[model samples]
Target chain A: MVCIDCSSSSATARLLPMSHQHVALRRFLRGPLNLRPPCCSFPRTFKTLTVHSSASPSPVLAASITSEASAKVIDGKSVAKQIRDEITTEVSRMKDAIGVIPGLAVILVGDRKDSATYVRNKKKSCESVGINSYEVRLPEDSTEQELLKFISDFNDDPSVHGILVQLPLPSHMNEQNILNAVCIEKDVDGFHPLNIGRLAMRGREPTFVPCTPKGCIELLHRYGISIKGKRAVVIGRSNIVGMPAALLLQREDATVSIVHSRTKNPEEFTRQADIIISAVGQPNMVRGSWIKPGAVIIDVGINPVEDPKSPRGYRLVGDVCYEEASKIASAITPVPGGVGPMTIAMLLSNTFISAKRIHNFR
Target chain B: MVCIDCSSSSATARLLPMSHQHVALRRFLRGPLNLRPPCCSFPRTFKTLTVHSSASPSPVLAASITSEASAKVIDGKSVAKQIRDEITTEVSRMKDAIGVIPGLAVILVGDRKDSATYVRNKKKSCESVGINSYEVRLPEDSTEQELLKFISDFNDDPSVHGILVQLPLPSHMNEQNILNAVCIEKDVDGFHPLNIGRLAMRGREPTFVPCTPKGCIELLHRYGISIKGKRAVVIGRSNIVGMPAALLLQREDATVSIVHSRTKNPEEFTRQADIIISAVGQPNMVRGSWIKPGAVIIDVGINPVEDPKSPRGYRLVGDVCYEEASKIASAITPVPGGVGPMTIAMLLSNTFISAKRIHNFR
Candidate 1:
């Protein structure tokens, strides 16, 4: 339960996990260039490098190499729980003060299993935090107009503080058209170009930062990792995770380089990074050799691979090779448990923020 | 005026000049983080290095080293003229086809000589391109409300295709407020957060790309300097030039990194770049050693320094030390004549585009 400062001598590497919820948004997962995925090998054996204590001088390097797991797992589930507890208190106070509960409306157009599971989890989380949750499920063949009508209704509803349209909307639906229709005030997903534009501009601020990237940054702040003046490299340039993540990092005064599929030598850029945020969906693509010693890693790619050992027949892994990265990085996020929980946590937080802003609540 | 490819054997280095127009926007010239300008030495002697032909194999390295000038100057004046010729033809065609002439309206609140000069140059450029031009001049003591009123008028004027408010408004006026008042549709300056957001997003296209950066990229395209997959470093994060320039480079599929004043060891990043775009307003801050052999240099900083030889008592210089950098770079833009003329060229282009879009001429 202890959160150790990443710089401390006793600190163990922490994994910043990728978002499992976004997996169903498969169409959006491709690199920004929409280039064919570069050839990559997966399920590779992990090898631990010799501990170069003097050369690296990392906190983990200074710590005793244990026979058990060396990385002190960053428990996102626990962190998320703590955040929810705090949010619950705030939600109660807002209700007591104003007699208005924050409301989040989700429009799920299709019944993809993963999308359904994500929406259900979000609803349950919303209810637990004392926020009102509204869901509208439509058949897979629904027209774009149908979705836009639902969004317009939610946007005008004074009680609804936030609106989210589950991604990878049916092929027939124009994603941008539907997403753009959601009023900027109710754009809890932060996918609207105007919000994104604000995020990119120097003096302007976005109403909401997209959830998963926001969570990745929150983890860094919570763990007290300094971003200012650091050389950071972001792998992938997806609109959701990688692009915004780089923008956020830059806003924090970090010198950032974006390495996408089109980038010829991604490892060369990653090797120079003090911090690396990888949202590319290729699991274990970032090998140990690609990392700088004592770097902070935030792997936003959660790819599932076959696992006969698991009851689900598959298990999730991050874009980074966790087994190898844990030994080299000062801190990292583990897949499944890391950024996945933080995404929903951030969505709830954003919803509360939206409601508070809308009502002029303190 | 042979526009030699940067990769050619006879390729001469081009100096990408920084914008002289933006210099008067002193308040906006400060870095994004509002960090104090880093203490930097200037007006240093430019020393040429020994030509090691086999070591670098650069085109300039392979070409006969001339004593008078080792690098071939990139004539921004000529290139801009060529682009204007192309644009003029387009404007004539559109006018003939639709009976609509592109009109550009400029709002100049203060009487700063530089701003006035820039506006006049733009007006003249518009005239040369057969686009209608409008000018509104107000006293230096004019209120922001007065400026906003003018902008609102221009916004409503269907004949005014593009609207530009001269920068560095009076100290009492809020710059962002005034800039935001201009309708996004008519914002030829591309300073609108929405336009910036669209520029940053993966698939969305901005109504207008900021002129100076657009000009810099245009110069690159004209010269056939490949941007895709190249390591490009943009120094300075000023909203007008540096930030947009980085985004533009990234959109071209280059692996882009932004180095601001807060960035430690700026040379380290610049040294790694195949293309270096220096927009920081410090004169000659980037030296030859900071550049990689055969790297393309785009100097967007036009800083004034004392020069007894000049009739005006001062001369303009770029952020990069031209004398030293030319030998190392494959191409560069010279100060005053480089990005300066290109900025006006781009403004005319954007204005034409705005008019075309408004009329649905294309």
Candidate 2:
């Protein structure tokens, strides 16, 4: 778990005054509008703050002003395992007490290896948690109607409490239409537009939020990091991760700013964020220099960067340069172990919640 | 409209270098997070900007730091009339050619004077545009079932291309349940969650955007203001205005940030905005210092502030201070004549668009 460095020196005290009209004008222009305006300087370096994790790079020169300090490891795998154990216990309890097992149905329309692996992993996770898992393996050339029909069948199946249709279903199939067909009640993936709408509006609750963003926030909560009244920035405005993450942050009472492709200088927004969740899938895009001291970093990006030393000739890296970020960021999530495990964990949690709600398990 | 002060010495060129780590740190904290520090100062006083529009206030002390300057007025009344005239011509053309006339139906659930006046104004607007108008007034004590039934009736009426249920429905009724009952095809007010969801999603178009925000953006377009690549800040997070307004600005390729009640130092966000559309009903909540010089101002607020000299003993004011804003902003919209007229105009526009889309009218 990323350590919440509450005692660390923060840049909050050095906040420039807005009373100087000249300085205020300068700051406003230097914001997102002037992305590459030669140099928009700000003092960020404090004392030595370095983080060490498995495969975490050594601190770079970016934090030269500070002494070396290791950041607290945000062990997502352990936390996810803990959640899985909880679910396993609950699933066995419900099964033994009421003869009711939580069931999840998956519809796989294509033969893409990645999609197949994901479906297999989900089923295995369900099995490990003592939940029933059903799968429909459709051919790569399956029609959109065929996919929708399977979704409808799964939707009506009383035994199936959660349904997930593997994404990237043949390009010919209308993605939105197919994803929307799965009833919101069974939308374990939570890709439904209605659910997203609910998430955006205050006072409305979505049945489920998209798993990835939910996992990121869950990690923060499990670590006891407060989000309320904090300045959080979500990099990448992708519907699945960035947008939902921002909405979730806002729901938690954090002032959120979204930095997207259209943004002029995304670093300007990121530098001020107390918590940053980057999901742009661009390797090392969030440099250490873009970070504010004592800020928490949750990298959702998983880009395959070339690694000649590895057997696969490439290794996965996140949007943040772990080597540099480990020096500056108070706490940061590693590439593979950070958000990935949490995604599966949240899916399991949502499924368990759905099943419990349906049969009045309480 | 305030004069475009491009000639004013900008601080962009004076932007400090990012390579200086210490300076960057200070600037980052000073950006938005530390809104009110003890020594925080920024000189924002450019000149006294006094805008006089139909009883708008005189220059206030907030704008006293600079000399007086007047902003170009955004004549919402004229713009609205132009839109109405265009709609009227289109309605007549359709009637003479295809014998098809657009009709709007309203279901009023309470007897509030403000609601009645709005309904009457809408009816008159419809008459002026040659669109058929129908109304059904229900008692305040009416049950949700009764309101739903009336909505169903209007939904089935073929001639009613657009249907609006006046908001602030009786306390006893479920607002969402009644509003959802209106058929999506005739959802002229565009309050449906699905419509809002579509509006939020990129590449997905809403059947209609809520009137006020849509009108604000329309005003921007009509005035030839380019939204792309601009920094926009929307004040207030109401479903009808602030939220949708931000979404609309994003759709226009602007980097949009939303400042709501939870936001700390809302003025900091507003100060950098190249375009500001304020919907919060706080009279003079936005002062001259809060605005960027030469920024476009769309004041959606219409708060009735007390004024003894006025015949009504009070006058309407937008969220922005018109006098100060007129001096600093490149263009400013007056309260009563600004978004108020634009709302009705947009409602008419949406109804016309709905009629054309449904009937395949070019």
Candidate 3:
């Protein structure tokens, strides 16, 4: 799916001038770029990257934009690039020293475009980090046993250091049972309940944290945004992003409140947050009025809303309206480049870690 | 540990007049009682039971009492008794029809008197419910291997339906490794991270929910307290209670918030809560002013402070000062009889469920 600012392509390349774009492009295409702050230098054309100035508000979404102050753009692409570069170097070091390559296996049950895009992105990230990627795509009507058979095969494959079954599997299959089949050691997605349980418990650490939430947390860490003892509010309580995000925040010692679909006054809770990471896929749900000024926002929601003026029928936007939050928030990650790139980068890092742990490659 | 209102004896017998006490005493003295509400009719005397009615508020802490509205006491003992008695009948029926009696094996690692008392009470409850209880007491300095050996044996035993490893194992042992050793099917205490993870997820059922939080929720259910669409604030972020309680509340569709030690102005959050469950161990931490009027308070903390007037050197008081909170809350659990006995009762219930599942003893 059109990963907006959360995409590393934008995180790393959003601020790149025309001249730097070529340098970034050449380095990225060559693979294994240097471990630098501006890491991801993908060469994709940003036809949809609409630049908004702090002085001017777009007429189309003018009602949503209330704050005049420009928020410091949290360059997730650069940070993800840096993390990917680190993983690349580590993977290379492990390969050179131990004669082993980190491998990740992806099992796709159905042909959902968004799921395909995510898997493709993950594979690309693995390649950049010198990790081997294996993929098995099944038709929509695949039986539960067929999916389980693939997972069982991967579980036994010594070369496969990590396994990820793309989520939202076809309605016929039982999701929990399938995910539970991936041996915990190879669970790179960190969707396993045990991993989540470990994450939720104080003084306990998970083998691998779920990628998106981990990325959101990594952004906060890299940006030096204080989370410990801060009042944080997580919107949405989904297992993948919101719940884990809240658990991660709690582990960081933040007093966390989770506001979800049943919440009577979600905005009231959001306004009390020192940090807000919203994963509800509602376009522009969190407005300037809901945010506490100077609060940090990490929007995980990437909703494609209809935009008749755009070349594409729809334009990608995060749960928070960027125009409004940018002015209100002291710092906020833009939709495409913010948390998106980090998810794939984390996947690569997890694969590298699994390989290291398996081989005792320290 | 001075088990107060949460104690079965006090819960079912505290309000019983002299003549009913004898009838209750006879029924409790017998091995297993019938499926009934107000089930726990133990003969534990009131030497430690200090009654503090609203008519005679303790002069020492009188300043904290502001509201005069008396709260409806949520008798956990009676509720726990009812649950236990129901289990008692089921166990008898299972034994007669299937010749399979549910057996629980508890492993205690330390010589802590409080832990011993808790174990004894658990064993007593098992007998009262017609469930067989097995005990393995190890020295304080027991090795990890020794503990695992017992767990493995229990796991293999055909008779054992449930297994529990008492918490606060000596400092020398690793807690997580030991707890993880218990087979998930027999994890009656439900401290297993996998069990906790299932509790956290939506549309997923845990093999067993942890006892304390399960008891708290059971109390709410029995009291006819609606958690759905309600605002719930769980104090403390402890794995055993606060976190699971929040997860359970969320599953029940309540908007849940976790307030911890690091939280700034926790009272502000508690005041907004329609249901407040303060599990933090600090004595009298949640004051009258902290609670919203007509809120339901489930004080899970059982802290002992010095009491010169009592026969025991110290008396048990919950996190919320009952004198103040009783007036402010619509319903409040007493320290001893509130959530204590329910913990043991749940252990029996989980065992019964395990036996039923294992033997298909319908």
Candidate 4:
């Protein structure tokens, strides 16, 4: 068994003696106490490591892991596989019992490579989960009326449980108008002004939550992070990421502060946070010095930087400087393996929730 | 000019020499900058004094002075009056030119004295603003469907630009159901789930902001409080007050933290704030020590505590320990004279805004 000492200069640390009683309690809570794993079964006896900065020489406590010695790494790929499997089972059961399969309709306008990749992945996820997928690809020159007609058609279709329009639509298309056209019930992206409004206001819960932020919270819950009364700082104020993340953090009883472009000395605020969720899309924007030692870091940025060793000549980087932050932060999620996978998982969860609501399923 | 230095118990300190130009600028911003003087305008300068405290010797700065040589009091009553006048003129103009009188439909269930008072004030404000007021007082035993049916009626009424259901309906009625019944466009109270969602989310603005919080921001803007980059701490997280106030503070570019029931050591957060908006409704919950010397205080609570000095045998108290806070705080809104009047003015403003949106008026 190896315990990574966060206070040490080395990437790894020595292992510590495990407490049998605590392990038993963790197992019980991760099993019977939780209704669903959201991904996979709980592992036993993972290593708890602390990373230390060479300059400070003081050990910072990172997250406690289970199955330290022989536990397989819980990467996004494996976790995503587990989620897809669970969803597949649930979808099949619903279909056999009620003759209803969840359906998602995607509308893509203009061929932006990134948008196309996202749409393709969504379609693939739908198929893996036994959800029927419909794709509507429009030409770059499609008129606003053309997009509206498709949205109106999907709105009336009872079989279509979710509707998502690829973002960054042609500059000429009124994004608001196109988005508003989607029926509230089918707004799986939760970008509808009404849904966004509901999410922002107190004493209200939206039918659908924006996927990315929901995913971040799910990760925290799965990892058993205590959020209540903790100080959480969300950097960036984008409609999709920073705003919703702050609201979610607040809902979970965290004292949340949102730092945006106008926020002076954001690092000061970030340094005080026990949890930092950065979605600014700036490469290595959050340095190790900005993080509070032992803080949980969720980096949502997916920037590509030059990497000569790779065939593509580039590697994906997170908004946070991972190598430096990993030494200070208690738990840090890597770029491609972090929030990205959770986004699709949350989308599937939202779809399942929508279906349950529509069918009045338990 | 006389400045009361509330920071010190002795209330004695040297007055800094203020240039004539500085005094003139302060006067212009506080007086004529207000489109209409809510009431009387005081002298440009009265007294300049500083208070010193052992904890922190920094003095609170005072801006305008009333006729009594008192520090400038934020006249919410007068400011609200000015807003109502503007709304009235707009309503009259709309009526004369477009043949439409902005109408507010209010539904009151049961006979809660406080709700009745609020409803009455709203009706009076509507009349004063030249907007038609529609009232429906339902019996205490009104069912959810009955209340929803009334909401539907208002939703369909073209003449009604705003719909507000006095909150705290009989326990039997589903609050969410009745609130959701109001169409988003006509939900002037901004309590509808959709509107609330928009208010909570980023990059989205609610068509109508909740009345009280909106009034608070309006008061700040009218009083020329610079919100940008300020540290704001809001006590409480009620949907109507704390939550919306935090969002508004964020909208104004302030770094806001919401301290609620679950918050530990709330005073620790409050003391760091440049502005404190307390709406917890707990009488005198916030003490002088919780405030920063120069912090602006907006007390939204109007709790009636036991005070047997008058015939009523009760006196109004705010969430803040006002007497002590007024001494320590740079600026404060008195309970009776602060947020109360602004609530009705905001309601009037919302009704007018709704009318303008519906009519597509410039």
Strongest candidate by DockQ:
1
List candidate 2 segments past 4 Å from native: A1-70, B1-65
Counted clashes in each candidate structure: 17, 45, 24, 36
Model 1 lDDT tens row, A326-360: 76678888876877788899999999999999999
lDDT by residue for model 3 over B219-319, one digit each (tens)? 99999999987889998777777789999999998988888767665665776788998775555667665666678999886666555556865566776
Q: Residues A146-254, candidate 4: write the lDDT tens digits.
A: 9999999999987888998887678899888888899888898887767776776555677898888888887777778889978888987666777888888987889
Off by over 4 Å in 1: A1-72, B1-69
Q: Candidate 3 vs candidate 4: which has greater DockQ?
A: 4
Instruction: Give fnat for candidate 3.
Output: 0.67
**Top-TM-score candidate index:** 1
lDDT for each of the candidates? 0.75, 0.71, 0.75, 0.70
Chain A TM-score for each of the predictions? 0.83, 0.82, 0.81, 0.79
lDDT per residue for candidate 2 within B38-156, as digits (tens), equals 11122434544453221111112132325555678898999999999999999999888878999999888768776787789899999999999999998988888888887898788
Interface RMSD of 2: 8.8
Residue by residue across A1-362, what tens digits does model 2's lDDT show? Answer: 32211221222212111122122222221111111111122234455444332111111213333534455667788889999999999999998887888999988886766667778889999888888999999998888888888889988988999998777567798888888888999898776777877787765788898888999999999999999868788876656777778888988877777776666656656666779998765556676666766779998866564555568665666667665677667888987788878988888988988899888897
> Is candidate 2 or 4 superior in lDDT?
2
TM-score of each: 0.86, 0.83, 0.81, 0.79
